[model samples]
Target chain A: MLNPTITEILLSLMQVSYITLIVLVVSAICGLILGTILTIIVVKKIPVLKQITVTFSSFTRSVPIIIQLFIVFYALPPVIESMGFSTTYITATVASIVALSLYHGGYLVEVFRAAYRALDKGQHEAADSMGYTPIQKFRRITLPQTIPVALPGWGNALIHLIHDTSLVFALGVVDIMGRGQLIAASSYGMNQVKIFLIIAAIYIVLTFLSDAIIRFFEKKNKKFKLDSGLNTKGA
Target chain B: MNFLILFEDFVQLLAVVPQTLLLAITIFILSILIGTVMALIQEYNVPVLKLIVVIVKLLLRGTPLIVLIFLMYYSLPDTVTFLSGLVGLDYNGTNIPPAIILIVAVSFTVASFQAETIRGSFLSINKGQIEAAQSLGYTPYQMFKKIIAPQALVEAIPEFSSSFLIVMKAISLGFMITVVDIFAEARLIATDNSYYVEAFFAAALMYWAISAITVTLSSKYEEYLHSRM
Candidate 1:
């Protein structure tokens, strides 16, 4: 087969990356929200559900993002297709979201659980006495507090999802790594190395930026975030 | 296809079990060994290594390990094969040297995370505990060995086992590199039977089982760690 041109390959990879941003952003939001819900489930049933939640989170958490990506991108499409749904761009978007939502949601579960655990019970009771509905109390009294608290860990998951975007190459989605692979296939002497290394560098820089943002939020919530994780006192 | 025919293929595929387990176990042992040292270096703030360690921490922490597997698969064999020819150990396909390369590549990543667990466990030892050791006239090394290491190991096992579970999930990357683990075998079956669903169902169940065992082991290890304290 003829080797594709360097510029074309790079452009294709870039195009893949452009679409990937949508996946990452959507997945980030969905994962965090779903994960928060999962956290609430665990909290409501701390004796049994808590253990199950923690176990599921840590188990999924233990798997590498790459395998999860493969399971989502390659494995799921066929499964979905067998059920009669077309899974074309779902390849990129749904796959990323599924992989990430499961993984990132796991991380968020802990963060939300920790944040809720650490909130002074007096605040909840105070809101309760004022006749606030549970939903209203969560929106005003609970969620805003948890967002700042969860930001650091959630930010880490966001960066992680970005880096993981490169793994879309498994089914040839033409993301940055896919582009690097193409570039490697095309050029001579050091061009392949240059392209791949550049992609890796971009990934690193993005993560560093994420770490900074996470730290920023962490500082904002340092008092709450630190004491949140280990404070086992009931609400 | 008849049931017996598929059953035979399943049996054949099961033969790869040893390879998968062996690869996972050896690679993890090596990774933990390397990772603990890296963790210790990061903990004690070892000289100029900290900068390198930080760079590595980011690289391992951020990059999808499958990418690392690819880099190792594509990069290492020629150099390793060439070097081995001189020593005449005759290493190739049988040993699946590429798998070892993937293992090494993965170690670098796994170690970065494991280092955090180690560092956390180490730091959790508290200042007075270290002071008590120093008061007993123990050197820093002596204190770590006689006092800190025991507690840290106990504290770390639960998390470390979880890390091991993480590494096991990572082994799915091996399929990409042609290690012929269950996933790869399943793919081959999918191709032959054109039953992508069945093959994948088999594969998913296999992965879930593997995941279940891993979770069980880690939790048990956590319980064991708790007992020692």
Candidate 2:
């Protein structure tokens, strides 16, 4: 058996990047929506909703991602079937996305909550005194300020999401890691080291690229802070 | 869901808790030792070694723990064989236990994060205090013992505990390499009974309970440190 060619490796990595990008975007959006709702429930101390949100977050955080993936993969089909829906369409990738999105939301709750709480009480009071409605206040005063503060944490969460997506291969998703497994198995386990090394290098490069992108946004957010005079005021 | 099977699965999973905890503790100790060395190298700006440490940390941080485990699983045997051959030990790589590979690989991954945590704690120490200690004619060891170690340890406790949780969690990946920890046992039980949800939930509950206990104990320890100060 021969080693996999460079093109095969690159092609597999490209597929990995593509799948990871999709998971990242979809999960990040879902997580943000879930996180924002949970933050509201917790911050406003909404009765039952707050308890459920807290419990759910803790559950997600405690379990390993792989276990969560397995749970979702196995449990979701039965759930949908019980609801009188077809379960055939729920692929490993879909389950992976659902589990990972929940995981991301679980973590982002704390991030957003911390960022939201870190906002000055004066800002809220000032908005109220200005006769601004709640929506108007949130959109104008709360969002812009909270975003710059949350940007760093959000970036860190995104990096984590990238890493977590690698576990999807365990569910038989043909991501780079899965592709490496296939290649190694095809070669009768020859060149297993080389295949894994290439995969690891690809992951490192992906992380480096994402880190640079995150830093870029962080810098941009810093400028937004300066323009809004948040720095001078030290809020 | 069959409640009886779930209860049985939970009991079966519980049997492997000691193995999981042992792996976690060993990995935590090894990683802390390795990470501190990396942190000290970076802290003191050890010339060429610092650069290597930084690069290795970057690589480790970017790569997922699962990938590291797989990489080690595949590569370590050959590397071990080559090294032993050079030393004329006539050892076979196949003799290495998968748990050892799991420990080494996971330690490298966890240690990178630990190194950053420790280095940050070291930097958190006030420069003024160090200057005061120096001007007071304190030796290096004295400065570390009297001025730096206590403060840095306190600062590091929160991050250290979180890293410990991470170490605990990472041990679950050991199942992928055939380590018969809680996760592996859970997987076996699930396969036997086809009750995936119950098996995983039991494992998750065990993990959560352990994490909660760790968190409480660490916080208590932190409080004790504070009270002594």
Candidate 3:
């Protein structure tokens, strides 16, 4: 029955941005590391570990992220406590980051693996001929190429992650969605649609901004590669 | 980790499988129907509707589905009342079910994704074939039916399956709206059994099983399609 003021809407949007920023930054960093590790484990085909990692990735990928969120938020602490670990300090935000990173990391592993597979065998051979060690070859040759190829998919994962951060509200995190609910609740259940429409618009703008940023990097990467003259068959 | 409790919870959660599956099926069918229309509109490049389609796609795809769900579940009655008022009709608009609202919200988001998939397939259709069809004096409908649909369908199948999986995963969010889907059932079981970990684990297994089956079926269907080609 009450309209949210311009200031209230703007303030809520700002708060949402802060929460989203935290989740995105944390998930992106942790997911990249986790994904890379999973990719390597699979690619190197480690005994037992490879199969286990593959299954874990597959399972995580198949299940909904919200389910994963619930597991991490609710199930994991008890499981951890049963194993003699304390999780008293694991707040909702931490749970959200952990769940989201794991969820996105599963997809990122596929992207990294596929990008690595797409590279020509000659690249590896060339690195080997140069007396480069495995790690050195990966650092100097493999990563550079894989990054460009994986960037678009990674960008998509980031966008998806951005949308998913809203689900943190289900954990009662007072994120943007939570704030919208609060606004609606304060209005005695009125203006629910109007408030959410505004919030959704803000999200659309955020999504557009992320897309533009990713596109800009993609273009810059292309230009940098062409100028460096590594633009061979891989290019 | 009580086995008996987990088993009981699993059985209880199983009862909601039909609701979950029906929601997924309804959303999948409606989204595909809407997606096909959007794709066709894009193909024709209808002036005003094309702009609206692009805007709708961006809006739906850009926003999180939960927000849309809240919008739909909370706003539909008000919207109905407003519309009815404009038309001079008496309406209270309170009998709508949450499941229907969830389906409509999720379908709007999924339809945008499906539209993109269909549009990509349409874009992949050969320009030369279209020109040849035109030279043969084929109408737009005839050209689409004979020359475009089959080719696009082949290209679209993989994306369609992926979208189908997405729709399946998405309905789990319906639990947030208290739709009594399996996920919601799991929460209730957890509250009742006080074994949150075990209850959620059982639910996860169920979700994983459905997803695995869908993936297997899609791959097999893809193989069959390839064999025909």
Best by DockQ: 2
State what share of the real interface contacts each candidate retains.
0.29, 0.70, 0.74
True interface contacts retained by model 1 = 0.29
Ranking, DockQ, top scorer first = 2, 3, 1
- What TM-score does the predicted chain A of each candidate obtain versus native chain A? 0.76, 0.91, 0.90
Predicted candidate 1 versus true structure: per-residue lDDT over B14-112, tens digit per residue: 766678777777777887888788887787789999888887787777666666776666656655767788798676533556667668877778888
As for TM-score, the candidate ahead, 1 or 2, is 2
Model 2 Cα displacement at A38 (Å)? Answer: 1.7
Tell me the TM-score of each prediction against the true structure: 0.80, 0.95, 0.92
* lDDT over C-alpha atoms for residue A47 of model 1: 80
* lDDT by residue for model 2 (A24-77), tens: 689878988888888889989999999999988988877788888888988899
Find the 10 residues in a row with the least total lDDT in model 2 chain B: B1-10
Best of the candidates, lDDT: 2
- Interface DockQ per candidate: 0.32, 0.77, 0.73
Compute the DockQ of candidate 2. 0.77
Higher lDDT: candidate 1 or 3? 3
* Model 3 error, position B162 (Å): 1.3
